[model samples]
Target: MWGSDTDVLNLALAATVAATVAAAGWLAVALARARRAHRRSVDERGWLLERERESAARTAVDEERARIARELHDIVSHKVSLMVVQANAAREVLDAMPQEAEKAMAAVESAGRDTMTELRHLLGLLAPAQDGSEPAPEEAAQLTPQPSLSRLSSLIDRFAFAGLPVEVRISGEPRPLPTGIDTTAYRIVQEALNNALKYGGGRPTEVTVRYADHSLRVEVLNSGPSVLRGDAPAPPQPDGERPDGAGRGLLGLRERVAVYGGDLDARRRLGGGYRVRARIPLERA
Candidate 1:
C-alpha cells in the first residue's frame, strides 16, 4: 500500500512539469509572431512617408512651371502679334516708299531682337547650369530694361504700326508704381489689345488710364462683338462682371489680377462693343 501511494505522487508531479513546459512553448511562439507584425507595420509607415515626400516635390515643380508660363505668355504673345502686323505693313509699302519701308523694317528687327534676347535670358536663367559658374556680364545685360508703364508708349506704337490704333486717355497724376502693379497693368492692356486685334476686325479701340487715390484704373474698349480668334477660348461675355468666365485669355488675366488683389469687370456694351475695365489696387512690394 505504501509503494502504491509513492507511485501516484511521482506521476502527479511529472504531469504538472509537462504542462508547464507546453505553456512556455506556446508563449514563445506568440511573442515571435507579435515581433514580426510590428516590423511589418514600421516598414509600411516608412514607405508611405517616402511617397508623401515625392508627391510634395512634384507639386512644387508644377507650381513653379505655371508661374513661369504666365509671365512669358503676355510678353511673348503681344509683342509677336504686333511684329506680325508691322511686318505686313512693311511688305505692303515696300514698293511705294523704300525708305519708309526700311524704317519700318528696322523697327521690326529691333523689336524682334529685343524680345528674343529677353526670352533667351529668362530661359537661360531657368535652365540648370551646365557648370558651377555665374552668368557673364553680357548675359546679365539681357535682363536690364524691364518693361514698365514708361515703355507703354513703345507698346502702343507697335500696335499703331499694326493699324489697330488705341486712343490713350489719362486722368489723374502719374506716380511711381510698384513692380507688381506695373506688370499687371501692362499685362491687362496687352491682353485687351491682343484680343481686340484678334476679334475686332480692325475696329477702333480705346485705352483709358486713370490713376486714382487707391488704385490704377485702365479701360480697353473696342467696337465689335467680343469674339475670340481661332479655337482660342472666348473671354467673359459682356453680360457678366467677371472678366474671364467666358474665355481663356481673360481667364488667365483673372487669375493674375486675383493674385494682385485687384477688381476687374469685362462685359459687352449694349450699344455695339466689348469693354474690359480693371482697377488694380496699389500695394507695396
Candidate 2:
C-alpha cells in the first residue's frame, strides 16, 4: 500500500509538470503572434505616411507649375498684343508716312526686346543647376525685377503707344504694399487694359487705384463700344480664343486675386462699356 501511494504521488507530480509546460508553450506562441501583428501594424502606418508625403509633394509641384503658366501668359499676352498692334500700324503707313512707320517699327522693336528680356528672366528662375549649385553671376544679372505698381506709369505708356488712350486716377494716400500684392495689382491693371485695347473699339479707358483704410482697390473702365466693331480687323487672338468678351485672362486674374482672399468683379456696365474691379484686403495679404 505504501508503494502504491508513492507511485500515485509521483504520477500526480508528473501530470502537474506536463500541464505547466503546455501552458508555457501556449503563452510563447501567443506572444510571437502579437509581436508579428505589431510589426505589420507599424509597417502599414509607415507606408500610409510615405504615400501622404508623396501626394503633398505632387500637389505643391502642380501649384508651382500653374503659377508659372499664369505668369507666362500675363507677360507674353500683354507684350505681344502691343507688338502686334504696332506692327500692323507700321505696315499700314509704311509707304505714305515713312517717318511715322519708322517710329511704329521702333516701338515694335522695343516691345519685342522687353518681351524677350522678361521671358529670359522668367525662364532663368525656372531652371537651376543640375549640380545644385548657385546660378552663375552673368545668369543672375540677366534676371529683371518683376512688374509692380511702381511701374504702372510705364505700363500705361506702352498701352498708349498701342493706340489705347488710358487715363489714370489715384485716390487716398499711396503707401508701400507687400510685393505680391503690388505685382497682383499691376497685373490686374495690365490685363484689364489689354482687354480694353483688343475689344474696346479704341475707346478711351480709365484706370483707378484707391487705397482704402484696409484694402487696395483697382478699377478699369472702358468707356464705350466694348466689343470690336464688325468692320474693324479682328486682333490676333491669344490662346486661339476670339477676344469677343471672355477668355482665360480674366479667369486667371480671378484666380490671382483669390489667392490673397480678394474679390474681383468683371462685367459690362449697365449703361455701356466694360468694368473690371478688384479689391484685395491688405490685412489678409
Candidate 3:
C-alpha cells in the first residue's frame, strides 16, 4: 500500500508542474501583444496631430488670401468703374467738346495711376518682411478717408461730370451718423451707380436720402427704356435672391446691410427701370 501511494503522489506532482508552465507561457504572449499595440497607438496619435497642424496652416493661408481679395475688390472696382465712365464720356464728346474730352481722358489716367499705387501698397502689406506682423488696427489707419455719406455731393458731381445725369434729393435734416452706417450708406449708392453705368441704358439716375427718427434710408433709381434690354443683368429679383453674374458689388452691399441689421431691396421697377433701396438703423449697434 505505501509503494502504490508514493507512485500516485509523483504522478500528481508532474501534472501540477505542466499546468503551471502552460499558464506562464500564455501570460507572456499577452503582455508582448499589449506592448506592441500601445506603441502603434502612440504612432497613430502623432500622425493625426501632424495632419491637424498642416490643415490649420492651410486654412490660415486661405483666409488671408480672401481678405486681400475683398480689399482689392473694393478699391479696384470703385476706381475702375470711374475710369470706365470717364472713358465713355470722353469718347462721346470727343467731337463736340475737345477740351472737356481732354479733361475726361486726364481723369481716367489719374484714376488708373491711383489704383495701381494702392494695389502695390496693399500687396506689399502682405509681404512678411515689410509689415513684419501688422494685420489689425494699423490697416484701418493706413486706409485714409474712407468713403462716407457726407461726401455724397462730391461723388454725385463726379458722376455728373462723367455724363450720368444723377440728381440728389434729401428729406429730414441730415445729422451725424455712426461711422459704419455712414460708410455703408455711401457704398450702397456708389455700387448702385456702378451698376447703372454698366447695365442701365444711359438713364437718369436719382439718389434720395431720407433721414428718420431711428433709421436712415437710401435709394438709387435708374429710369429709362434701355433697362428692358436682355443684355442688362436680370433686374434685381424681388425674391431677395440675387441672380448669378449680376456682379459682386451688389452682393457685397447686401452682406454689409445685413451686418448692420438693415434691409436691402433691389428689383426692377414696374414702370421699367432698376431700383436699389437700403434702410440702415441710426442707433448705436
Candidate 4:
C-alpha cells in the first residue's frame, strides 16, 4: 500500500511540471508575435513620413522652375514685341521715305542685337555650371551691365514712349548709391511702369520717387479700371493652376522686387484704378 501511494505521487508531480512548461512556451510565442506587429507598424509610419517629405521637396522645385520660366518670358517677350512693332512700321516707310526707312532699320537692328544678347543671358541661367570652372572675363563682362541711378531718366522715357504717361518727381539732393541698391530701385520702377502700360491701356500714370535718409520710396499709380471692379471678374483657379502665358507678367514683377528685400503692393484703389507701391531700404548701399 505504501509503495503504490509513492508511485501515484511521482506521476502526479511529473504531470504538473509538464503542464507548466507548455504554458510558458505558449506565452513566449504570443509575446514575439506582438513585437513583430509593432515593428511593422513603426516601419510603415516611417515610410509614409519619408514619402511626404519627398512630395514637398518636389512641389517647391516645381514652383521655382515656373517662376524662372515666367521671368524669361517677361524679359524676352517684351523686347521681341517692341522689335516686331518697330520692324513692321519701318517696312511701311521703306518705299515712300528711304531716309526714314534707313533710320528705322538701324533702330530695328540695334534692338534685335540687344534682344539676342538678353535671350542668351536668359538661357545661360538655365545651364549647369562646370565643376568649379572659372568664367571667362569677357563672358563676365557681357553679363554685367552699367545699371546705375543715372539711368532713371532713360527708363522713364521708355515707358512714356510706350504710352503710359509717367511723371518722375525726384526729391532731395541726388547722391551716388551702391550698385545693388541702385539696380534694385531701377528695376522696381521699371516693373511698375511696365505694369501700368501693359494693364492700364494708355491711362495717366503717376510715378513718385523720393530719396531720404537711408530710404527710398517709389509709388506708381494708374487710373485704369481694376479687374475686380469690372463687371466680369476673372474666376480664380484651383491651386496648381497656371494662368495664361501672358498673365504671369505681374508674377514676374513681384519676384523681381522680392530679391532686394523689398515689398510691393498691387491692389485696386478705392475710387478706381490700380496702384503699385514699393519701399526699399537704401542703407545696404
Candidate 5:
C-alpha cells in the first residue's frame, strides 16, 4: 500500500511541472511579439515627424517667396510708371520746348535713380552674409529706410510731376503707427496713386487719410475716362480688369491688407472714376 501511494504522488508532481513549463513558453512568445509591435510603432512615429518637418519648411519657403514678389511688384510698378510718364513727356517736347524736355528728362533720371536705390535697399535686406551672419553695421547703414506716411508728400509730388495732379487731405491727429502698418498704409496709397496715374485720363486725383481711435482709413479717388498716356484710347475691359494685365497691383494690395486683418475695396465709382479705399484696424495691429 505504501509503494502504490508513492507512485501516485510522483505522477502528480510530474504533471504540475509540465503545466508550468507550457505556461512559461507561452509567456515568452507573447513578450517577443509585444517587443516587435513597440519597435514598429516607434519607427512609424519617427517617419511621420520627419514628414511634418519637411512640410513646414516648404510652407515657410513659399511664404517668403510671396513676400519678395510683393515687394518687387510695388517698387518696380510705381517707379517705372513714373519713369515711363517722364520719358514720354521728354520725347513729346524734345523739339519745340527744349527747356521743358530737358526738365522732363532730368525727372526721368531722378526717378530711375530712386528706383535703383530702393531696389538696392530691398536686395540688400534679402542678401545673406558671406558667413551666414548678421549684416555688418556699415552694410546695414547703407540700406535706405522704407517709405512711410512721413514720406507721403514726396510721393505725391512725384506723381504730380508725372502729370497726375494729386490733392491730399488729412483728418484727425496723425500719430506714429507700427512699422508694418505704416509701410502697408504707404504702399496702399502708392499703388492706388499708380493706378490713378495709369488710368485716370489726366484727371485730378484726391488722397484722403483719416485716423480714428481704433482704425485708420485711406482713400484714393480719380475721375477718369481710363486712357493710357501717349497711346490710343484703351478698350473697355470687363469689370475688375486693370490695364496692367490682370490687376496684380490691386490683388497684391488686397493680400497685404488681409495680412493685417484689414479690408480693401477698389471699384469703379458711380459717376465716372475709380476709387480705392482701405481700412486697417490699429488695435489688432
Candidate 6:
C-alpha cells in the first residue's frame, strides 16, 4: 500500500511539471506577437511621415510656379504696352507729315509684327503645360523682349476698356519715356485700375496719366460708399499693400513699380473712396 501511494504522488508531480512547461510556451508566443505588432506600428508611422513630406513638396512646387508666372507677366506685359504706344505715336507722325508718315508707318508695322511674335512666345510660357514635362529655361530666354517707351496709350486704353475710365493728360512735348519708366507707369496704372474695379464694388473709377519733364505719373481713384461701413467681407489681397479687399492687386502693383525704382502711394479718400498714385522717372528709353 505504501509503494502504491508513492507511485501515485510521483505521477501527480510529473503532470504538474508538464502543465507548467505548457504555460511558459504560451507566454513566449504572446511576447513574440507583441514584438511583431510594435514593429508594424513603427513602419506605419514612417510611412505617414513620408506621405506628409511629399505633400509639402507638391505644395511648394505649385507656389513656385505661380510666382514665376507673375514675374513673366510683369516683364512681358509692360514691354508690349510700350511697343503699342510707340506704334500709335508713329501713326500720328505719319499723319502730320505724309512723306515722313509713310516711313514711320513702315517702321510701326515692322515693330508691331515683331511685338506680336514675341507676345505669342511669352503666352506659350505663361500657359500651363498640357503634358507632364516641365518647361525649359530656353523657352523663357527666347520669349523675353526689351520693350521701350512707345506703348503707353494702348496700355491705358486696354484698362479703360476693361472698365476703368482712363484718360491721358500730357503737359510737355511727348518725348520718349524710358523703357523701365514706361513699364512702371503702365503697370502701376493697370494694377490700380484693376484694384478699383475688384474692390470698388461696381463704383466708378478714374485713371489719369500725366507725362511731365522728368517723370511720368499715374493716378487711379474710385469713389463709393465707405468700404468700412459696408457689410462686405474684407477684400482679397493679391499682395498686402492695403487693408482693402484689393490687397493682392495693390501688392502686385507695388512690387512692379518698385522694380523700376518707382514710388506708389495708396490710401482711402477722406470723403469715402480709394486712391492710388504712382510716379516713375523718365531716364532710360
Per lDDT, the best of the predicted structures is 2
Full candidate order by lDDT, most accurate first: 2, 5, 3, 1, 4, 6
Model 4, 283: alpha-carbon shift in Å? Answer: 4.2
**What is the C-alpha lDDT profile of model 1 across 191-235, one tens digit per residue?**
888878766667799999988888889899987653343233335
lDDT of 6 by residue, 197-217 (tens): 445654677767777766677
Total backbone clashes of model 5? Answer: 0
Pitting candidate 5 against candidate 6, the one with the higher TM-score is: 5
TM-score of 1: 0.67
Assess candidate 2 and give its TM-score to the true structure: 0.80
Kindly report the root-mean-square deviation of model 2 from the true structure over all alpha carbons. Answer: 4.4
RMSD for all candidates, in order, please: 7.7, 4.4, 7.7, 8.3, 4.8, 12.9
Q: Give stretches of model 2 more than 4 Å off.
A: 1-38, 226-245
Q: Which TM-score value belongs to model 5?
A: 0.79
Question: Candidate 3 on 222-257: residue-level lDDT in tens?
Answer: 874433454455555453433332456677677778
lDDT, model 3, position 73: 78
lDDT string for model 5 (1-285, tens) is 999999999999999899999999999999999999999999999999999999999998998888889889889988988899989998999999999999999998998888898898888767867788987798778776888999999999999889998999999889999898899899989998888888777788899999998899999988775333333434545545484423877787788789889989998665656788999988732
Candidate 1 accuracy as lDDT? 0.75
Error of 2 at 116 (Å): 0.8
> Deviation in angstroms for 47 in model 6?
43
Of 4 and 6, the candidate ahead on lDDT is: 4
lDDT of 5 at 246: 39
Stretches of candidate 5 exceeding 4 Å from the true structure: 1-42, 226-233, 236-246
Question: Model 1 off-target regions past 4 Å?
Answer: 1-57, 225-247
- Winner by TM-score between candidate 6 and candidate 2: 2
User: Distance from true position, residue 102, model 2, in Å?
Assistant: 1.5
**TM-score-based ranking, best first?**
2, 5, 1, 3, 4, 6
